[model samples]
Target: MPLKLYKRGKVWWISGTVHGQAVRESTRTHDKEVAEAIRVKKEAGLVSDHVFGPKATRTFAQAVESYLKAGGDARFIGGLDDGLLCHFYDTPLKDIQQNDLDDAARKLYPTAQPETRNRQCYTPFVAVWNHAVKNGWADVRQWSRPKKPKGTNVVRITKRRAGTFPVEYEHAARFIAAMSPGPAMLMTTLFYTGMRPIELFALEAGEVNVTGRWISLYKTKTGEPRGIPMHEFLVPIFTSLLKRPGLDKEPRLFRTPRGEPYEQIATDEEGRGGGGLKSAINGARRRSGIKDIAPYTGRHSCSTGLVVAGVHPHIKDQILGHAADDMSRHYTHVPQAPLIEAINKLPVPDAWHALPWLEDPLAWSGRLAEGTGRRTDLEKRREA
Candidate 1:
């Protein structure tokens, strides 16, 4: 129930009550001044808890659920914390050790598909445990350091796919142009502006500023409200889509053909539980002859496009609601004029035009509509 501060080797240490039990951690600062400051902060946190009555005892699992629930609404990628928290929830926080974690990781490979298991389970384990230690809920010294199995070919096969999707803007434009009012605008907005799919989908009509050429996004991955300038190409598209004769009634910017908002697409019906953005991206990719594209790819495409066109990495990060001030990345924000000009300079190649498949509306509808299969008729004609 008491908090203590001391020095071990060169590192400053802080230890105190976590759910009325002792928990301790190194501040990881070798500098005496910095360590003292951190120790002060730790003591202050403990004092705050003492005055506030411990702010409800949250287990590792409970914290993860809370983090995800609050974070899920954010427009940014919620990192590895969610899954790790889930694993902690499934396994006892105190019982998990480095060896056990390694064993769990090894089991993921060969037995349960290691790569899938590592991403789905292992990485998150490291993250949430780290979270637990940082938040003073557990002693970092007690957690076991799970070692990588020697001679195990930890081939990181799931490497990030390299090279930007250069043709995304053009393909996006064509698909947007081809799309019946509702989806066209949604896709166009994603293509031009680098807003996360959730951020865009989460948009209410009021957040959009057609006259001012910017959109205000309240909930972002960084937990900060950011305003990004609208792409000039998108202004007309949004204005038309927003005020389109029959479309103005819906409060949301995008909806299904049947007039369902993107969020409400989940009707709890069979085979259509919560595809949301996935369904739309698959539909667009099938027609565009672009294989393996996901809805988030639009965001990636826009981000990379900006990067390629000489927009500052920090600005793109800011626009996408990324933590641009992450000193580790050493990024500098591109000024507004240069950033806008750079974005305008993106090369949106007409790659989809080369593929004749997307010309038909039936091919573009998510999951082939009936009587839309060209191969079936071709086989019949050949037989005849």
Candidate 2:
């Protein structure tokens, strides 16, 4: 039977069989002429699919749906799809080409930089197209991406910078002292281990081996397990934090003042994750009079400190979890002694020694107690 349209209340509904398949859907209009047009288009699409197979009718929207359903990362893809769907809703996947992508990029982000166009538009489009190719809905074709003008440097000036910055120990110490205990400890760990913010946020209590003085990171930005040696300064801090009451039941090693785990990690265009310590760090920045200190500053400081201390580049790479060029990284029995020695060489300035937490690692415990309505041994001692 051919497709037929009938009025269901004020709206026209489509119901019929086309090419051995049943179709029943709303034309979603009160105008009979508009409904008839939609019904005709739908019938023609069904006939084309039956004659040429489903690939001839597959749309970019359909490819995106399949890609996401197959567990593709939707962090940026979902947002990119909003504009892309408007342009390619009914357009078949086979019809999209490199020129169409270039046009779409220009239309979507007229003033955006080449890097921004590449990340925000071309990246997601190519990803969806590649997924479609894998599913045999579209042919494989290399899409040209927008590139920055050659021989010209583009400096984007924003209030908050995204990547790492140089931070000295004295400045970092002052910043850490200005923060509340939880964030102070968290920042201190970041400075010592140079771990990514996302990796630290996802750290489990079980992953920290204070006895062995090593932090085992099972998931990293590089998708490989990393072992970071605990700095001597951090050994006492983690030892104290891990020994706190009820920590045995808590999976996350770090928490906010309210004793809840950090929020989910979010990645920016650069693919770096900072998780959730924004408010605390911002408050500390105001108090410390350090306007440039961000969560990633510590990681940069650690690397610089290691370099200034004259540690070898290879050992520094090992400590910082940078991809190594040598075969030593592939061996399971690689020695941690060199990495440990390299990390310890990071100098602790006098400013760090003056911080109160160094004397009593649990000093932050008082603040946690205030939030949780529980008193720590230090608070009880003070009362006594």
Q: How accurate is candidate 2 locally (lDDT)?
A: 0.73
Candidate 1: where are CA atoms >4 Å away?
A: 1-57, 68-86, 90-119, 122-168, 171-180, 221-223, 244-250, 264-279, 285-288, 324-339, 348-384
State how far residue 194 of model 2 sits from its true place (Å).
1.6
**Model 1 agreement with the true structure over 1-384: per-residue lDDT tens digits:** 555667899777877774454658888988878877876766665565666533233355644554455553221113345334333454545566677766655644546544445544555555555555555655565434434355666554553431223345665565543334345456556667776655666676767777766676665533446666677666655665565334445556655544556763221111122336446444555655555344455677888788777777776776666744445223221124544555566564555233232333222223222123332332233356
Give TM per candidate. 0.55, 0.62
Best by lDDT: 2
Whole-model lDDT, candidate 1?
0.53
Poorly placed runs, candidate 2 (over 4 Å): 1-74, 79-109, 114-163, 267-274, 312-314, 324-335, 366-384
Model 2 shows how many backbone clashes?
Answer: 0
